[model samples]
Target chain A: MNAVEAVAKPAASKEKRRTFDVLEALIYLFAVMMLILIVYPIYFIVIASFSDPAAVAGGRMWVLPMGFTLDGYQELLKHSNIWIGYKNTILYTVIGTLISLAVNVSAAYALSRKDLAGRKAITLFFIFTMFFNGGLIPTFLTIRDFHLYDTFLVMVLPFSVAVFNIIVARTFFQSSIPGDLWEAAQLDGCGNLKYYVQIVLPLSKAVLSVLALWTAVGYWNSYFNALIYLKDQDLYPLQLILRNILITNQMQSSMGTGEAAVIAMRLANLMRYSVIIVSTLPIMCMYPFVQKYFNQGVMIGAVK
Target chain B: MSQSNAGMLHTLGRIRKNWGLYLLLLPAAVLLLLFAYIPMYGVLIAFKDYSPATGILESPWAGFNYFEKFFNSYQFDITIKNTLVISLYSIATFPIPIMLALMINQMRANRFKQVFQTVTYMPHFISTVVMVGLILILLSPGNGLLGNLFRLFGAEAPNLIGSAGMFSSLYVWTDVWQHAGWDSIIYIAALSAVDPSLYEAAKVDGASRWQRIRYIDMPMLLPTAITLLILRIGGLLGVGFEKVYLMQNNLNISSSEVIATYVYKIGLLSSQYSFSSAINLFNTVINFILLILVNQAAKKYSENSLW
Candidate 1:
């Protein structure tokens, strides 16, 4: 096929010299349409957050902010619990990412070694949980038995190492870092820990960055753990707090009536849009910076 | 006997030599045991009449009482029907991302491709709580963007979130919106790995753009697609509990009550620990069986398998 194409290239080029084609045009059109569909809701939320609550509720606000006001943000910021949620979430993400990365990366490195005794068994031990689990009740029982319920550590400690992540990292180590490198390091009297820390760690920047971003984002957005394990409002992450607000608003809008109902409705409308922005702003801001690494990271992890 | 002894000695020597590596694995092993394996033992509580005072082990045996109760309960048919419907709905939407990736891959401009990819993948990072919140806000019948759009066209917007009929579509489509771009990443990666020379050959053969895609790109993407499809089918029953739980309301409970959410309600809220555990165990068993069967089928039909 290559030889045939090489011989026919000149003739084909002469006939196919049209710069634009219907297919190309259609592809571009589809891409633009999808871009709008994907981006418009997010854009709407941002604009809606700034619009007046009544205008927003009345369907007046669409492409632009209607009767622009910071009242929603003002009310949200004034609520001290949102600040506490932020503080708790930031702490969880930071500490949890570090702990997760350490546990996952080290485990991955160890399992990636072909010479490691019982490597296959160890990997199976981890992967088995992906298919079947104890389900919700038993897991809750175990957490309670460990005395981790309502504790801050319950948020960060339990469920720290993701098996999927470990597998991805292990696959990365196997493919990217050659066996010869480890052998070479051993020849230079570099012990396992030293070699891993100095050489392997430095060389694995892309995977490490990907793992860090994934772990950090997961911890940042997680609400399920907080919902199940932590009952104390003081320890609640931002998602839980936002969730409470959203549910309350939904309840109020559906049930409430009279003057107080009207007031509650407006507040609910404002908070609905504002809370979306508040909860997701940090992650959305960080996404662009990490977008470049995502392709590389996802490819490495997903390929295997 | 000598060879077996030598193999044992080799394993022992390796363990002794790489003690540090074993030490590194210690924390993960311990954590997995405590959190994953220990809870697995808790699944035994399903077979027993679990009492908080007696703990999981000491509870008296109830044989198949809880399981029978769940199978015979009124919630049984509704929950299973809802679970299968939603799961099948989700599976149906799986190819949207593939189509998106194919469209993105077809684009000639590099800059547009990068921008489109970045913008589309952003939603995957949004928390489920926030995602549902956005859905509620945007679909709010009176004041939401959907309502406003309907009004612009001289019609009232249906209460989309409140309508039982719309629940599954809303859930599936919102999921597609949130995850399609992120999911497309793998396909894009797969596409990039396709041999460029194949495209050149097809071009010289006077193949149209559609023909090139049909003959060249589709073949290259099929293996990855099949592997992913098998994996998706394997976990067909394991619909995410978070978003569904968040989006669930009294109006849409008929369509939204999945096994996971039902289990949470029964086990945690209603305190039917044994019954919920039995339900969960049943769900897990079905999922495991499906996974193995799918994996085996993929292995037989295609070269790609998860194993």
Candidate 2:
């Protein structure tokens, strides 16, 4: 209550504030370091793609492209497999996303209905697969027996029923779409299919888009299915093509000794950087914009 | 008898009314039958001397013979050891994402927090193929980024990607880098749901920042973290096949030959269908048991569990 005591209290709290400031500073420092650690490698790849192979090898290029050239991209463009991969991946992603959304969203909605008969049994039927399944050999054999192997449909159809996506979408419908809405639709003489198509699908765009993006990304980046099922070169997706170029050491080659072989090898190394940038560019560009939608899916799941 | 007949008729009426719903579910049910259920039925081949020519059903019975072969094989110990080592190492780093989430929650500036999260989560969009490719390019001992940096110091860059000793570390840490930020999203959502009044109450009590995080934040994130940990433990042996298969070379095969990859190589590449199916059957059974055990333990110990 006294002026002297009030002044002393102010001085003591300021001292506490100073230590708090130090902790705040340390937190900021941690964030900045993590930012650098993640962004730097990606930045390096972008710059390295344009830089001359020799300069990149000599450590001359770090922050900026050193002795910039379009040689890597030029060489990559010349590879016909890369073009085939792009077309195949794009086709697969679009068709696969549509199939996934149709099957999962419909199933999700059907199960979301409290009045739907056998909802619990149907949901359990889907969820049980999540916990246990026959491993790869049996699955592969089944696909082969179904005659889906080595076909384009193999990429999109067999793996359509993603249980996790269905669960998330079902949660979204249960929580967001009211049971009264279905009752209202029924009173208006709308069938379950009509209500789902016209009303529910239109209203559930947020979750639908999120599921679509996830499925599309899965299809785009998929190689294991392609690797296992398809033996034809023409059927390969971008990831498989990238695997051959970047990991499998199957770079395009010509039989030439000494200097010519060395040039070919250097071009191959330089192409690795370009190939990564080319393949991942679309996802990276689209990610920042749609990042919130992906988070939306997580939040929906978390609430469940 | 009359009461039972009435109940059965009522159930039949419900099914007849909801026939459209069943129609909607038909595609998914059929897909599951083909891809999932049939594979399960096909797993019976593990107990048979599976000849692809004879098909899964017609394959002659050879109960436990292939299982015995796998148990007696030299690969049994090596594959199991490698799978466990990688999985346990990954689980050990599980706290990193929780810690990152906690740190991000402490930030005073909203814009900086968003930028930090976005940047960190960016790596996750990079596919497994590109990710392993980046690993090779950045660590290639001859002319990689590390190689170039080492040359500056007149020292040789060790072959990290191909090194048997570094296999697990490289796999786990790169996975951490790619996923920790994305994983933190769930915890961050959990943190955001914390009532601001709780923080105000803590501040009024003269609790320091660390004290607030300890008393308030830690308790809030505990249920979610425990649930995630249980799921992680349940799928302990289910290490992904993509990244490991991509990263494996002849040099590091000793440490990188996981159950998933081993099955792929054995069944598909070598066409030892019965042997590979048996190994796979064993792996799936163990994974399912672990999941059930962990879920049960969590249900008993805490309120949060996967039911």
Candidate 3:
């Protein structure tokens, strides 16, 4: 009886191992499928952008660039407005990120302090806005009333200090920066401002970088504000400008007729792919450097 | 009453002692007041027969007239239904990320896991316009990648972008594609935090891998999942404006027209401020109530809640 039980146990263990192997294989298959789904479109865009427009339109460009040419990129770059859009976008991103970080970090610091007066009420006040706000028309009117309708300040000022960022920053400060450090600073005759700027800010580099990257990315990608506020063509950010180019190309290709129409359609298809690559290239390039920090930052902010 | 008075005085004294902290908070407070709070006052326009010339303050009080109008309008039913459909579609796809995270966690190779994560997360950084453009290019019937694939199969390529019925699927699936990896980060973090001893114990008990995952890992992930689910439901009606707007065309406008885009059109394009404001107010109030209800439900059911 003991010998028979032993043999049965070995057979069962072998069956379990085979099931586990199959399960592992299934998981790998799913992961690979998801990877392809997420990546193929972006890759197709890259190769298509470089491929000859005629080949791309004819559906011959697959897996690799067919009749590779730089005409699409050349056409995009030849439009001088793309460069201005780049410059404007960069300026908005930098200036807006600085302002956002300054306003949000300071506010978060104050809120993070347990002894601050009316902190609960202040926090609620800030959070209430996240759930409710004036609709589009009223916000637009308010911007116009402030005399910031088409000005560069309109891009940076009104939208600074995101409530979500402030909350995350406040949470980071509370959890990470020790109360003992504050006490130690106080013992050294460090005032609140001095302690915040000298001790706390220096210690809070992780949260600061997180906030900076988030704010910069938001500002860089923003188009709605420019779409509504900036009427001046010269002041258009990269996104709004790119949107226009893409839309106009679509309209031109779809609406036109005859030989000129065919040519326009071909160029538009080329421009469409190139514009996507050009607009996204900078952000994509910056992403890898910040990706590790970003994962850590999001986890730290999200977990609590 | 005396205890409350004392508490108030204590807070005031603390504030006086930490005046510099108050100074630190001032700039953000002022910005919040001007942008967030002040715009809330503009919600009053919904209650008025607002006119641009008379301004928001001087506009004649109409007392639910705009609200009644919005409720009675033809656009009301379509927008609300469209919004709910799209949002529920999104909610349906929420579990995809959790499942993906669990699968990724099962990988034996650390290097492969990292590569999978990095590649999948890349799409989240793509701007809305670029994302929409990519979608269009890939789905374009005449010359798209999908079209080419369809041709390979000896089938006609359907106009996915132009089909109203296909709008929700495209929006939801593309959203899953872009965000599944990024959203799975929290779940991955939660999975890693589960005790290693539990897995060893389960192994000793002769538990299969699936059984271990079901009994041990899943239970550990529940609190985080519940918390995230509650938050997602709270913002369910606040369907992202930019992506929907970019994806909208005359072809699929029937399915694509959400409260946000409708508000933009009436409020800004056609200059029907009061009507759009009323529509927006309805949307926000419903969202707020949904948030509260979900938060309460979460608190009652589980230890995890937003409040």
Candidate 4:
């Protein structure tokens, strides 16, 4: 290459790099602004939860907690229903997730085996539910008819068959698990049941954990079932209890009058922030670690 | 005849061989039959005058009476209009995640990209109950953060949560905020699949970054975008019940009352089982038909479809 050509190429590339640098900077600026838009509200809530109710309402608790206090948390913890809600929610999430994983994973593994009979027909049965369903009232009636209404079993048993979970797990099994392993296991005198339990599941930890976390989070957040089916307060989950405190109770408090009204409103406001923190902090804390596995599951599902 | 008999025998042999797999599938099959299929059968109540004491089977037939009632009712137009408006509004903002993914993919700083993604996805894990609660607390005109901001400027905060005009915006925008980062994952996956050599080739050819993104990334993401768009369109009428129900009040009821909440009120709250079932059945049918139409259209016009 001649000197003039070499000089021209380097100059041209330099201009390109300059443009890229400017564009990259703009992208970063936009991302950081978006990040702050999301994170600031959460940060404000944390500070406001600790700040005195009057200071928070008076607009003094901006950058940091002004006249910091723990009355909100103290009040929230004192509410007896919250404890019951927490116990019920933990029980439901653990038991419901176990049931969900058991049914979904087994069905997915069965459907994933190419050697399985009538696979296409069975798969279509599950997929059809994704397109259409019985809607709300009928399902509620079905639950009631089965005597699952207003029971602990109602929270964990009836709604465990998630077709989307089945599809995702099936996709994972089909793509990630080797057919060669099944053949080798069969040669080693392993039956289908033993092979799945021993060989397949052990190798599928990433997908299993992903499914587990998703189901657990789902169960933790679910309240509509409780809202519609259960009348018994004893079986109410955290989301239902939180809803009563955060939304329903706020209305009742606002309708009151005089000094009591003002006090009730202030306490209600304080307790809301605390309740949010209590309900979501566990999930948020676990989110960063479980995020990659979720992405992995999504990637596997998307390959379809 | 002999060949067909042999084929039947082969199928039976496969079934016999896979009895263990069949056993594994039994739990899910039974659950779906109980929860999914039985409810589907119970949907016959829409065509019958369902009395709880008499049961669905013994309830007298109502035929098209409930369907006609729903069609004539004022809520019919209101709920359909509200559902479509909110759904279309959400669909219009569909490009936001694609844009977010493209921006994140363009970032040369890996550390910043990872951090940005982590922070953004955090909001999605916030339960619907907590999310609406946050909306209420932060938007309360009497003493929320927005109220404090307004006070800083010597003004009162607007009644955002109670305004009918603001309801759809509140629902759609908050939904976007919570989900856009999570939704961008699929596009990000698609972008990562683009051959690195393609980027290198464009760079060596002296293409600018904008040009590279336009030529390389956008095209790669189109199929996934179309697929997701189809899926969204399929579920257009199926707006969520929880958030809208929680956010609702006397003030915003005109705008916020969609089909799901309407059915809940009429069926469970009012004890008009047959009428509510009709409305719900209508909604589900529309959703199913729309999905099929969109999937077919996509398959015909392009290469992407759910099937």
Per-residue lDDT of B27 in model 3: 91
Compare the candidates by DockQ and give the number of the best one. 4
Name the runs in model 3 displaced over 4 angstroms: A1-20, B1-10
| TM-score on alpha carbons, each prediction | 0.96, 0.95, 0.95, 0.96
Query: Candidate 4: which pairs clash?
Result: none
lDDT of 4 by residue, A1-304 (tens): 6777758798656655566677788888889899989999999999988988999988888889888889899998789899899999999999999999999999999999999989999999988888778888899999988898899998888889898888888999999999999889888988999999988999889889989998999998878998998898888899999998888876677788899788878888888888899889888878877887867888877887
Write one digit per residue (lDDT tens) for candidate 4, span B37-58.
9999989999999999999989
Q: Pick the candidate with the highest lDDT.
A: 4
Weakest 10 consecutive residues, lDDT, candidate 3 chain B?
A: B128-137
C-alpha positional error of residue B110 in candidate 4 after TM-score superposition, expressed in Å: 2.0
lDDT of 3 by residue, B41-64 (tens): 988999999888998889999999
Model 2 complex DockQ against the native: 0.73
Model 3, docking class: medium
Q: How many residue-pair clashes does candidate 2 contain? A: 0
Q: Compose the digit string of candidate 1's lDDT tens values, residues B1-307.
A: 9999999999899999999899889999999999999999999999999999998778899999988998999999988888888889999988888888888888767798888888889899998888898898788777778888899899989998998999999999999889999999988888888888988888889998889888887887888898889888988889889999999989999999999999999999999999999999999998999999999988998788988
Candidate 4 — which residues are off by over 4 angstroms?
A1-19
- lDDT rank, highest first? 4, 2, 1, 3
lDDT of 3 by residue, A9-46 (tens): 97556655566677888888888987888788888889
Minimum summed lDDT over a 10-residue window in model 2 chain A is located at: A248-257
